[model samples]
Target: DKYTGQPLHNAVVWLDLRTTELAKELAKEGGQDRFRHVTGLPISTYFSAVKLLWLMRNDPAVAGAIREGRAMFGTIDTWLLWKMSGGHSAGGVHATDVTNASRTMLMDLKSCEWHEQTCKELGIPPEILPEIRSCSEVFG
Candidate 1:
């Protein structure tokens, strides 16, 4: 099952390209030169992070999958990369772009990495998480 449920109805899925543009504009407007390296997209509620959380709370299967690490969670691009790279489970590339990671409300924006504190605050386990990566990269 693809897990297409009604809760997903009318939900907005933000794309990385669009998010990157918005981040660029926001940085420019704020006159923050450091924003140059703030590549990728800006965080938004439409991303999978929020949805994933919702699912974990309301859907038992998703929660169980997460706990068991049987399911791989990530944005569209990450899913694509995983599939394209031979889907190797052992040492498989489980990762997310910074933009997508930002949307999860789980990563520390400054560090571009998963925030253990944030995970604890959100009641999510940090152990089964994927690594956050730069937006521009050549996937294996």
Candidate 2:
């Protein structure tokens, strides 16, 4: 979705280390221990939240879009699903399976849902988050 009315052609891949500093900041602010306990993952640049934080901090357009409540985020699978179902213009479903959700570092390991507290702490808009779904169910 081009929330900024400007096409965002780039993607911050999982292997991208550009979020390394942001990851460290997150670990310090929220503590690595708590993160592991809730998400069963360490605070690292490998996760989506950290990369998102980096973008929000560095990209003016992205930050503006998010602030305007027009941004959307998802992992590759979620993006693919949205495209397959229908593009944003078609009201595509933004959804993801539990296993894929677990890897995002934004979903609760137990509830398999996006934790509002964590999202607030990270300055991530909950509206941009994808809906959590069962792995076996058809999503959109």
> In model 1, which runs have C-alpha deviations exceeding 4 angstroms?
1-45, 88-91
TM-score of 2: 0.90
- TM-score, candidate 1, is 0.60
**Model 1: how far residue 112 lies from native, Å:** 0.8
What lDDT is obtained when candidate 1 is compared to the true structure?
Answer: 0.55
Worst 10 residues of 1 by lDDT: 1-10
Error of 2 at 34 (Å): 3.2
Worst 10 residues of 2 by lDDT: 1-10
Superposed by TM-score, candidate 1 places the C-alpha of residue 38 at a distance from the truth, in angstroms, of 14
Could you give candidate 1's per-residue lDDT for residues 45-121 as a string of tens digits? 34454455555676686677666656556666666666566455434466778777776656776888777764664
